[model samples]
Target: MPSTLPSASPGTLQLQPDAGAVHLRVAGDWTLAHYRHLRQAVERARAPLAADSEIDLSALGALDTAGAGLLAELIGPARLAQVGRWAPGLPAERLALLGTVAQALDQPPAELPRAGWGLADLLAHIGRSVQNLWRQQKQLLGFIGLTLQTLAVTLPRPWRWRVTSLAAHLEATGLNAVPIVALLTFLVGAVVAFLGATVLAEFGASVYTVNLVGFAFLREFGVLLAAILLAGRSASAFAAQIGSMKAQEEIDAIRTLGLSPVELLVLPRVLAMLIALPALTFVGMLCGLAGGLVVCALTLDISPLMYLTILQRDIALSHFLVGLGKAPVFAFVIAVIGCLEGFKVGGSAQSVGEHTTSSVVQSIFMVILLDAIAAMFFMEMGW
Candidate 1:
């Protein structure tokens, strides 16, 4: 008899080969561990074996499904040329064990599924943005309502502070703007006169230069230039002032002190712009006309009286009224946008500077856009 097989425990390795068979024994609580070792040993032994090979597990005392399946896998490749057998074996159970391990090894890896966004999700996002914008619009309307109420109450008061402040703002926005406005207006008038004289002098119609300059400045250039000037000056000033207050938490402090920032700070500025812009536009128009008059008298020898006569004959009251009418609306728009942006300023000096610059740029763009729309409407109305 072969040397009496020694009692072995789980994970013990034993290899025995006879003339025609290999008897690999796995003993005691046989598991996948025993199966793997046994399979590896057989593979090593098979390299030198004939095409025929045999595996016998006759003395296996206890074996798990895992161990049983690994044994089947070792036998599978040699099934045609060799025989596979188990002692004290249950065939059906062994088959089931092999199937479980095969299925587990063949299965794909687990993964998380992806969720996709569709049109409905996009629509929901847009709806949310619109709702937020609607709330802001309501808040702006409320500010306007409160302003109207305050103005109603304040107008009846015997205080001269309002008028005095208006006068000061008028000087600041108007008087201070005079030199640059005059300079630019003069240049513009000179250019217009040059272009008009160049073209009209060909036909001995140089006298028409006065009419072109006068009517153009009175009707459009004066108001447009005035609006652009205030957009740069007052709009930026308002944004910077409010932005600084916001950065410093001064607006909050005013609220804490039972004061209305709108009344104390914002309203005065708004009123100032409203009063100042019209006066500035009026001054700008006069300066522009005077400029054209100088160019005409100096270069074209057109008399001042003749230029005034043409202005009276060609420029209508409706043109003057339309230009003046746009001033207050432009003022209101610049004031509201500048203050709103300032109120939104965060606690950074950079944010204050950014919003101040943005207020001026955005107000100027809006002023031009609104002017274009107004021009279309007035044209449609045959103004």
Candidate 2:
């Protein structure tokens, strides 16, 4: 048995060494108030504890969680348990509390393994990205094919047509869009004329600004601007509208009522876009030309009559046809992409917003890509 040590003050430790063991005597207020001294004593007593050491907690007074935690850390959990077993004279509650703290502080938390930065990991990431891209392309193509199939099936049944919905969509997607499209194309036309005048004036060819504006607006800029604006405005609107219905389970409800969502919801919007875009393109062309005429009159001193005469003489009918011909194709693509994205929405408001944004981005990208291909084809064929 270890020799009895002298009583230590509150927040103090007394270490008494025996032949082969040490007795750790703790007494007084072992609490937050005396934490500093208790911590120092615990630290000093740490080196003396061995496998044969014993902790005597029977004399301890006013023990709390913090002091118990410090004691556990110093003596380690295994010896702390032995101390509890040997010192039954200690309060049961205090020993139980010490055991709880010992268990909690005994082990450190496990760390997560870091990812490898080897060539195999890099190649795997690239392969996953490629697979995702391929999957997305397949989904888009399948959607396009479905839309076309629905159109073919529905076209022969005039009795099934929803004229009111078609008219409403036309007014919403087309008539509502006119002012902004006209305004944007008009401003762009004026800017183009100004640029042409500034650049060509160096070569004493300022009058060519009229021809440049006429050619650009008729062949490219007018339809391109209108289509891009509709992509941002109308495509997003379609996605949000259909996505909201999807979130509410309204599409499923429609199907339960023996109605086709594609025919009822998508066809009207698609047809409306197809009809509206051509009219919008025509308006954009006129507004663009009017803007160029105004710039010519003010800056180049070219009268309206001379501008019209020059335009008629230099600009061919084929230029206008080339631009107008692309409108229906662009409109079809935008409408289908928007409705497809909307149908893809999951049952959440966040899903609606994400797919809406995606619809706009995809529509704009497709329109630009198609326009570029058409332009290259026309150029190669000398159309």
Candidate 3:
């Protein structure tokens, strides 16, 4: 070769001899002109370094696919070793093409050193998880805050629209739930009376069966059973409704119209359930008491008059109030869990269905757990 390589801009090539290494020098950007000269130089040196050849590309300021493709070709068929600082600002598409060629030739880039585990890594992972949880909490709170604001404005303006939602939710949650709640409560009462009668009759205390059924139903069973039913019926409905809206882009449409779906959809339903649950619980209590009365009169031969007197003596105003108080709390919990799962609905219809089912099941589980905690607290306080 002449003092200067004949072909390209201002790059000189120097061959080093361990096995095969080429030092490529360049003054400015290495364009296609430099790449052609690089190939010619490699061809001239190939036979001499047949066992191994390394093309060092670290000096180039810029390289394109033409250059990368040429390097890929030599590294593959010629079994050359490629060592380089690839140019910055290389297009992703070109890099991907080069990676594919390298992979096809079973020439993987060298693995970088692994970082050791330390306190820093543990803290980093924990921090990320906490941050994610915080973000979810913020989203949930934002939804509630925005819902309250929108309802404050809309309820004063078009309050009647909310009434329809209330009616709809009550019809779905309360009316639809009545049959199951009534049947279950009735059976529970009958079971209680039968058990009390069986055990007490031997001791000549069968009349007290009335007191057992009345007290439990009035204070605990009525509210607990009603909450469980609503958890299954209303919570699932809320999740399915909201999740479907999310899946169908209805929530997005509400946003586009400057409306909060939480207000228009969720708050009304929650309000309705709050109002309806107490009434439903009260009805369920009455049905349960009636069932107990029937069993007491027929099995124990206690007169209905005697049953009523015993119930009146055993049940108190505070007992009724406690059950009533629990209803709204249960309503709030079911509404929150349902709406949370609903908002979790992803872009797919399958996600909508899966989350709706999970919402109902999870709400039921939470209701039971909360009820147990409440019972413990109340018992500790001598309730």
Candidate 4:
């Protein structure tokens, strides 16, 4: 038929069919301007084309890449090759463009293989997690070793000490933390005393509340509370401070200037914590005892004089020493973990925040774990 397909643009497609062959007469400004009509016409005519069909582009006008692509898609590589064998009427430029489009379309689309929800996937996930944990532990051990080496190298050199930095870190980690540590220990001591008095009053042993508070605070509560608080506060602060510096490339600058970051940044914080934690532990012990004293006076009706008498008679000096002795170890571990996490930070704000959180978690875990191990050792040793 000579009839043009219905359209709103200058593009037109006329189909003429004989017994053995079909002819597609394309006459249009087959550019982006008529792309919609051209696309619709191609879709409508696609089903009716015979295996022996010819595309007559002799009447085609104003072709563009988009139109050529559409035409290539409609003809397909096999049918276009068939047309080339018989018709040979397409212009050199149009034929080349169509050939290029055909070659591009000949490529197979890439697709990712779908993972099956099987035991293999579950095992793989667990394997990856375990691997990550082992890697992290290895890195942590290496860092601890490096820190110890640096400390050994620097300790004998009096002039190498960063006294100013150490003093500043002590003020920040120790002095600044005193109030909270004291208050928390005081509150916990009061709670313990109250619980002790309430339970012991039934047995006419309410007066023993002071001894309970003294023993617990002196041997465990004071140092443990201070260590946990510092894990949350000072450890996080160390990570954030150093992590920010790392993100800003100041760590690189230090390296450029031939200053060891571990000596300048880590040693000061470690020394400060070693000095500060014991002092804080001592303050926490006193405040906790004072809280117990207040609770005993108010609720148990035990006078301050009687409370001191009982504490002095029952709680030995060795108990205080045990608690104080754990402080430096906890402090060193906290400082090292915090500084290590900070140094691991990548160059981003998100990385700084992540490492800061990691520092707090690792510090707290190490402190609690070490305390438990120490407790077991002391118990077995009958100390």
Candidate 5:
């Protein structure tokens, strides 16, 4: 029996110096089995070749992408492209593979031009931001229309009402929230009275502090404070709750069953909030007036009767009506925004958390914006 002699390593490279030019005789199973050895072999044999250097693939063996890539790197891209002329004995498919890899490696990558903070860049950024905001607002308006349509369809049929869910949400949104809304407005009312008394004392009109507190609370603070609180609490809760359901694909299941998610999930919450906010606002106004009365009695030596007398004389019924009137609008916007963000949730806890935060921010911002516009309108009307 003849000895194996280790059979020349599957991949082989031989460098020949010919007439001051180079001829590379390559041979072997250059597939990935010998990838490491082939790489090292190519690295060591990668000497600078004359422009006219030639490669001989006549003795080459089996090839693959990994092996062909190595061959392309070793032979130089310039010579690799014209392989048909240099190695006619090379298989066409292998020739095509080598040519493809060579072409790919030879070209420089294309890239976007880097931009600086110049006027053009600034304008472009502003344009993009405006476009995004417009798109978002359009979507919100469309969702509002959809919710109203769902409400219209669901309203005539009392059979479609989710009485239990509405009552539960009302308990949470209105009854459970009463203590905080009351306490917050009460404290603010007392502070306003103190400030008014301090400022009016110089004019011997400390009694006017009663009127001041009533006007501020009745006209602005009571409703504004409650809406802000709910925007933070209820809006975020709504987003998180529905977002979780969405992430679990429950909304999709409801749709698959030929039921409307907007009608089922959104209407109960919206109606509940609409009914709850005005009631909360009224509660806020009473607590605020009570707080002011306490402050006037203790600090200004004014009795509760006198404070009430002044409030009756100076604070018009129109002011209270104006404040209470804003609540339903605020409530509807908050609920709609929260539910919209929930519907937008992707399938992840991170998405739920993110949409919850976005809902709160959007609800509060809309509340403030609407409040300002309402204030201006009422002021102009002398309401």
Candidate 6:
């Protein structure tokens, strides 16, 4: 008599010597729970498994992907393709699992190349930077052309002029800024006069301090100072205002109504700057000369009469014209750069701040660069 009871078992492999080949029998659960012992069992039995071995899966139990992978390690990928002929009793799903695992294990992932720190890398970085700068300049040039085209088309009609907006921006960019611009130029003028007096006095020519102050302010410092001030002050303001509007989706709404943002938002600011900057430059020149005069009266004891005489004798109208002429160009570039940056906003507070800072930096750099070029041109042309 035999007892009829279910038995618990670990995975096992047994080899039997047959007529001309070996019979390899697999049994029990080939799962994660039995992975360690199953692996060791397969390792020990796998030595006898050759191309002509017989695989008996009829006695095989449960299986999973881990076990399938271990089976692959034992059988090798080439044998996995012919699993059907080797183990005819194996289920279709189990055959598929074994094939998949064998393929995955056979083809390992390739490694990624690491970056190097060398001269080639440095040159590559510089090339990328130059490309970015060129792209930015192209955008600026295109924007300028678009603004001019719009101006040409719109300015011919008096009815479409944005008078109220222009007035408001003019006051903000020009009139309200007068005090600060004037004060800054005045202080700079005084410093220049002091330095001139000190240096010239060493050569017994302290009286030429008046001529130095007049020539400096009339030809360079006056317009340069005013433009730089507006770049920092008004350019940031323009970028912030337009950026906030963009972030709030007001710009999108404006476009939905078929309104031109360039005309309504940008042109007014640009025209205002165009009108205000020259006036501001003139004021800056006067204020700077006054500051120099005061410094000379106090430090060098040069009379106001003598200072005027020296200014009239030494400084030509070309110097004044040269300084003032640069104002409109500076004004237009600053305004365009500011508005362009504003339009570039990504509809977020952080993006607005970043563009606002960018506008100011770009405006100042352009002003200085254009001024330098203009100086060289005037000097070459005998102005």
Best by lDDT: 6
Error of 5 at 341 (Å): 1.2
lDDT of each prediction vs. the true structure?
A: 0.72, 0.89, 0.74, 0.88, 0.89, 0.91
Candidate 6 global lDDT: 0.91
Give the residue spans of candidate 6 off by over 4 A.
1-116
Across 290-363, the per-residue lDDT of candidate 1 in tens digits comes to 87788888888889898888889877888888888888888877787778778878999899888888788878
Q: Write the per-residue lDDT of candidate 2 for residues 38-62, one digit (tens) a residue.
A: 7888888888778677667767887
lDDT of 6 by residue, 1-383 (tens): 86433236767888898997998887887887788888898889888888777777787787888778777877787787667777777888988887788778888689986677789888988999999999999999999999999999899999999999999999999999999988998999999999999999999999999988888888899999999999999999999999999999999999999999999999999999999999999999999999999999999999999899889988899899999999999999999999999999996899999999999999999999999999999999999
The pairs that clash in candidate 4 are: none
Per-residue lDDT of candidate 5, residues 157-197 (tens digit): 99999999999999988899999999999999999889999
Clashes (candidate 1): 0
* TM-scores of the models, in the order given: 0.61, 0.72, 0.67, 0.80, 0.84, 0.74
Q: Tens digit of lDDT per residue, candidate 3, span 101-197?
A: 5555665668995699789888988999999869865865676576567657777776446787788888888888888899998988888889989
* TM-score preference between candidates 4 and 6, better one: 4
CA lDDT, candidate 6, residue 142 = 99
TM-score for candidate 4, please give it.
0.80
Worst 10 residues of 4 by lDDT: 1-10
Of 1 and 3, the candidate ahead on TM-score is 3
Q: How many clashes show up in model 4? A: 0
Worst 10 residues of 1 by lDDT: 77-86
**Top candidate by TM-score:** 5
Candidate 2 wrongly placed segments (more than 4 Å)? 1-125
Task: State in Å the error of residue 337, model 5.
Answer: 0.9
